[model samples]
Target: MRMIFIGPPGSGKGTQAQLLSQRLGLLHFATGDILRDAVAKDTPEGQRAKPFMTGGQLVPDIIVNDIVNARLRSKNRPVKFIMDGYPRTLAQANSFDAVLKEQGLDLDAVVFLNVGDEEIVRRNGARWTCINPECKATYNTLTRPPLTPGRCDLCQHLLYQREDDDPATIRRRLQYFHEQAAGILDHYARQGRLIEVPGRGDIEAIYASIVKALGK
Candidate 1:
């Protein structure tokens, strides 16, 4: 099955995407990872995207669409794929449809994880990460605090909260998602290909709901 996962940051979309990809044998296409790889490889699209990235600006939709299409056109990529974080705007969603048509493929579903703003702030605020490069363990102050406060359990490195994970940043991100995602959500809903999954409770439970939604 070809699918896309969409939600605000801290909504567990990435975690669910990773889990679902493994369980269903689907290629996981995460946009951030793809963009970073493209930039690192200095591919044509990457070269085009680098200036904007370096300037701390969003990469233009055309460049992002080109990279995504190129990946979809790859011969070695899996037939079934799960898209995470691509098509962040309505224009990108339309472009994605055209790309899929050219590639003789169709998206089966778009899963929208419905998480509220307060939950987003609370969840993201508690996140802390290990400083060690090789042992990048993460702990949540609320849900999974490390055995030793302010230290990584595995590496004993100092655990620091990312600046972007602060409550204010999370609220801003959630607002941005609300502004950008409405049209994209409506597009999928009109196509009868949108699935709403609850973004609460444990990770396993949320994953189970998604599985059930997909009839897996």
Candidate 2:
């Protein structure tokens, strides 16, 4: 299934995307990860995206849409894929639809991970990630912890808090999510293609909710 995930920054959209892609055999396409990798590599797209990211604004739709099209056009790429953290605007949604139309494909549905701001704040503010490239273990200060504080149990690598995961940054991201996602969500809803999954409780429970909501 060609699916899209719509959620706030801290709503576990990435986590759920990774999991659901594994479970459903779909390619997991995360725009943030892709852009970050490009930035880490100092690619052309990253150079263009860096300033916008530093300002916490969405990167220009033209650049992002080009990257999305490039990935979708790759040979032997997965026929079905799940999108995470793209199409933040109605204009981007229209652009995405146009590209898919050219390719004779379309999104099956958009899954909105519906979680409250309080939970989003709590979950994101406490998150940390392993800085080591070889072992990117993720943990949270409150909910999930490593065997030792600030350390990854797998490779004993240091776990560092992402600046974006800080309380203030998370709040700003949440606000941006709501403002930018409103029109996109409503657009899909009006087309009878929006499926909401309550994003609370354990991973398995949330996974179950997503599965049921997707009717799979």
Candidate 3:
């Protein structure tokens, strides 16, 4: 199935998207990962994106759209895809739909992983990531811990708290999330293709519900 997964940061949508893609043989499309890769590679587009990204500003729509369009055209793209962390605005949704139309593909479902803002803040605040530029494995202070505290098991890199994981940033993120995404969710709902799924349970339980939702 061609799908989109929408949820606040730390709502476990990435894990869900990854698992769902594997389970259904869909390509996984993650905008954050793509943007990071582009910036690291310093491609012409990435050069254009770097200043804005490092400044903690949104990359312009044209740059993001171009990167996404390029990735979608890669050979071996799955007939189906599970998209996450993208189309965060109605404008983006329109831009994305137009691109897909040109490619002759249509989205099948938009999954809304509904988790409370309080839970979202808690989840993110508790998260840690490896600081080594070469390794960035993530862990949650409560849910998952490395064998050694504050260290990456694979690379022995020190784990660091992200600046963006602080309460202030989390609050800012939530405000933007509701402001930009609520209407897009409503738009999808109006089309009879939106599925609201609770995201506050065990992974398997959540995946099971997703399967039932998709009826596959």
Candidate 4:
């Protein structure tokens, strides 16, 4: 059941990946979470990644590849897992292929969550998050609105839209996503391991579509 979920930001690939991971009892290797954990722990790779992260810059491929390779080489490495938010570029994909080969593992599939740019913008525009450092709960006005407007349900703190969620920023991100996604998607497509699934609709429905696509 090893697979990777590839999609643009706000496309719900993360949500779908999490659901599928739970259903299949596979580890979900979300790159962002992994990087944050590393930075928190201040390991060698973490120390190298912190500056780029703090500067709001993308970490170099070498550092990211090193981190992922270390994990794959770990004694407790995940045998069956779902990758999310990783291999964002063609270079990373190539690096991952080498790592998988060294590990004697084969990727089963690469799920591509397809959603329109306008729809993504609309979806992300409605998102708001709790400002409380401890309670950074997120809400989407179009899907899961808070009980009280502009307030966090759990902490009663004011909710604000993330800078990245702004429509302009979203469009910029979508542009970057499309640019980088073409090569990665094409790479998987040529390998006959790419599976396309609609990313718009109810979360459960999307999850079901992904499950069916995987023949689960």
lDDT (10s digit) by residue, model 1, range 88-134: 99989999999998888988999999998998888888999998989
Better lDDT candidate (3, 4): 4
In terms of lDDT, the poorest run of 10 residues in model 1 is 70-79
lDDT of each: 0.91, 0.85, 0.85, 0.94
Give the TM-score of each candidate: 0.85, 0.75, 0.77, 0.85
Where does candidate 2 clash, by residue pair? none
Q: After superposition, how far is residue 2 of candidate 3 from its true place, in Å?
A: 0.7
Measured over all alpha carbons after superposition, the RMSD of each candidate to the real structure, in angstroms, is 3.6, 5.5, 5.1, 3.8
Per-residue CA lDDT of model 4 for 19-112, tens digit only, reads: 8888899999999999999999999999999999999999999999999999999999999999998899999999999999999999999999
Candidate 4, residue 12: the lDDT equals 84
Runs of candidate 2 exceeding 4 Å displacement? 36-57, 125-166
Model 3: per-residue Cα lDDT over 71-128, one tens digit each: 7766755568888888878877877888888788888999999988988888788888
Q: Which ten residues in a row have the lowest lDDT in candidate 2?
A: 70-79
Pairs of residues clashing in candidate 1: none
List model 2 lDDT by residue over 78-181, tens digit each.
Answer: 57989988887998898888888888886799999999998988887778899999878899889788989988989898998788878888888788788889
Show how many residue pairs clash in every candidate, following the order shown: 0, 0, 0, 0
**Model 3: what TM-score?**
0.77
Error of 4 at 67 (Å): 0.5
1 or 2, greater by TM-score: 1
